[model samples]
Target: MHSTRPFLRDLSDSRRKGWEDGLRDGYAEGYFRGQAKVIVERTKTSFPVRKIKVLYVSSGKGFPYSPIDEAIVETLKTLTASVITAETKEPIQKLAEKNRPDLVLALDGMDRPVEQIDAVRALGIKTAIWLTDDPYYTDMTKKIAPHYDYVFTLERNCIEVYRGLGCRNVYYLPFAAYVSHYRPTLTRSAINRKISFIGSAYWNRVEFLRPIIGGLMEKGLKINGLWWDRLPEYKQYPGGIEIGKWMGPIETSEVYSGTKIVINLHRSPFDETVNNNTAKIGALSPNPRTFEISASGTLQLVDSREDLSSFYKPGVEIETFSNSDELMEKVNYYLSHEKERQQIALRALERTFRDHTYNHRLNQLFGYIFK
Candidate 1:
């Protein structure tokens, strides 16, 4: 009898790799991907989504981008024969071989399986990478993106940068809200209300918040992020700065819902301490949190960006703050005028849920791929 052990062990090797991946990426992260695959496989029918088999490769090593990866996976599951793995690197080839997906859409090129990308594409798998951190990490993305058949950047400024680097099918695809998770929530938590900001204290942010720190504190501000020590006033307000604490999707959405105004300050691209954009391609697009904050039914007071208006209508659906004084002035006005703030938040929520979501973003991606 020909021993079938070789084939079975080969299959088991893949599962064993999953176990190793689970150890690296915690149990819940592993369960989320594995269980979702199981549930989708058991279903007798799938939605008329793209009608293509896709293998999703995620680079969310955990923190901020993890939820984004999960949202993308949930949307991909609606398609036919979707396989997911956070294992990244070497496993991509083995999984691609087993799954035989028509397209391999990798989220965030920073941590993609660069060496094996050519091999996967050689197997006739159409490769695409939707770059989450653009312009900022161009030093790295510029190298990784050329490996893909299609390149999607969150920053419009990088479209030309990639196109110039010889990536043929470059597209400007900004991040969208994971609507199901980021939708409006009831304000039932111990979170502070007047004003809030959720992101790292990048040197640029540290300096930007310097002038308005006192005013923000007076207005009952609470920040949930890391590296606040960069701010000279870190120890001045114990309750105001949450140094080194990271918030997940659920808690972040809750904070946004509870807060009257959530500040969306972007990290400076030219800051060498934090970014690898040696070429210093300017950033023009809003961050992923812009849609998430609006979808959470909170007034997003984002910093000015050239491409911000294209996605969000400022002063109506959203608000823009150019400098610290302007941001402080708006914060004071919005805090006092509850009706105006609520109206803007509601309008932004309607706009975000209507036009900006992972589903909408994916549809655009598929259109470009098929076209």
Candidate 2:
């Protein structure tokens, strides 16, 4: 009788465990399905994506833009029935003549195939250019914008700039993370870094960071980008700056994941020597790095911009600063108050995955084009 009772109890326990496991799996599957349904439903009223064919062109520029163009192409593939890719270095006109796609979409206005874009438009094919580096390179982009059927820019302030140049289809489309690559894929190191900045040392950055360079050196800074040698105090911080090494999206995501705080400072619109913004258009929108840092699950200390709050909740999803003094204080505070910093990072990560990814950005872009 005792042996029989033991077998019955074991059987009952096994059945309960299986039931719980099944319930958890069902919940997860249902949640995923629900999320997918929401995205699909959101686009139900938009244009029929399956009918369009896009010729996605990338300049194949190294560093920042190549990865971005690749991500844009990947998302475009899912949106359209067919996506043919061509490099600006190659003859884009020949591909357009061959494929005769419904629309030809190019990334970055720099190094444009001017004649080819004109040729594609002559073919009665809709042509669009998504300008990643806006306002900064507006000197070149202004000449390139009027040729395309649609002109999209990262800077909100440039919409008027483009429209003023007679490009009627100008739209404000901001940068976003390629979510599959930019995520917290790695665990933080045993010793967290106090701060990190991964971008080129433009004239503005050099001037803005001069005051706090000494403070940053003592706080464990990892600076990697071109032209750091331009900083006046470059020699002071030995072994702190790695000049001319570009961190691709995946590598940057890893750094963002391991670090405690990442600084994202926008380039100076007024610096003519470093930038080609002859028109002096203010770069008010957040750059691509903003979404990348947030999506990578790090507490981002970004500088103030006009459209910043439109994308991220101030002091909730992201932390911001107006100048070097404010940035230094936030860096110190977030470094010591680990729990609060982590909470903001977590919230930003969630917000980024939900709304600030390539998929989200392209959905908006396609809607505008097809509308």
Candidate 3:
């Protein structure tokens, strides 16, 4: 037989390249269109608009991509403000001089050279850095926090950290899902035996989920995602499916709609630390997966967190599990109780639409910034 292995590998590589190229092109074009739309809208408005031009900076290589960027761009467009993206702070500083935006929104911390931070600050433009990861690890606030006018954190836990650094304003802002992009399409045939989990394969997650993987297979549940490839426990579940890597918004929603149960696992890196140092450093920063999964209207079995309650009512808006036994039990219960499952999904959808959206977040952040 002809060797199809190399051919398949080459085809996969070509497809991935095509996808990346398409994303870059689409982003540039969409960004320009979005900016134009904002300018037009702003021109027609009579409201006393603040002379606020915003620049959003990103390294553009991270999780929960496009949706967040798209939301920021769309918000800028609606606000009729100038927004620009740069890979480095040097370019951003140059652009700041040219555009003279009122606000600088750094997607990650301003990790560029210290001189760049100094240059931007000298321009008298307000700087706001959005921290999406654990502040304990990166400690961006410690180094650059004092220089910025405001620090935006994805979790409430980081507010104190920023305040401790003498940052004048620290706002607790969680990641939000784009409702139009991430919605329920329950028409997709539910894969009765498939139970999906979508996230990076952190070591702690693998340990916590290993036994549940076996339990799932024994009960005829198929698990999928990047985790399965690295899972030594995978040999036990011979028939389980693995849908490697992360899926985009469209594919993720499809998976949520089609899968019988979707699992949301949070990494407990802070939980395991011996010293109170980490907790004093920062506690629960639930990943964006929580909102994304819940927004998809999938029946989610998420790991418990205090923040979860703040967003959801539990058993009403969504469901939760504390350990492996609880996770497996909830999985089996929801699978059997289709009516209750649908009701919970509906409530979760409503909650996401009302409060947990990008627009809602923007409104809150702007209120604080502009007030």
What TM-score does model 1 achieve against the real structure? 0.84
C-alpha lDDT score of every prediction, in listed order: 0.81, 0.82, 0.68
| lDDT of candidate model 1 versus the reference | 0.81
Residue 136 shift from truth in candidate 2, angstroms: 1.0
For model 1, residues 45-115, the per-residue Cα lDDT tens digits are 22356667888888747766789888988877765455556464456877888888888888886765587
lDDT of 3 by residue, 130-163 (tens): 7666544544446766667787887677787778
Of candidate 3, the 10-residue stretch with the lowest lDDT total is 39-48
Model 2 C-alpha lDDT per residue in residues 324-362, reported as the tens digit of each score: 999889888987887788778877877887788787788
Measured with C-alpha atoms, the lDDT of residue 26 in candidate 3 is 55
TM-score of 2: 0.84
Poorly placed runs, candidate 2 (over 4 Å): 1-49, 186-191
TM-score (all chains, Cα) for each model: 0.84, 0.84, 0.78
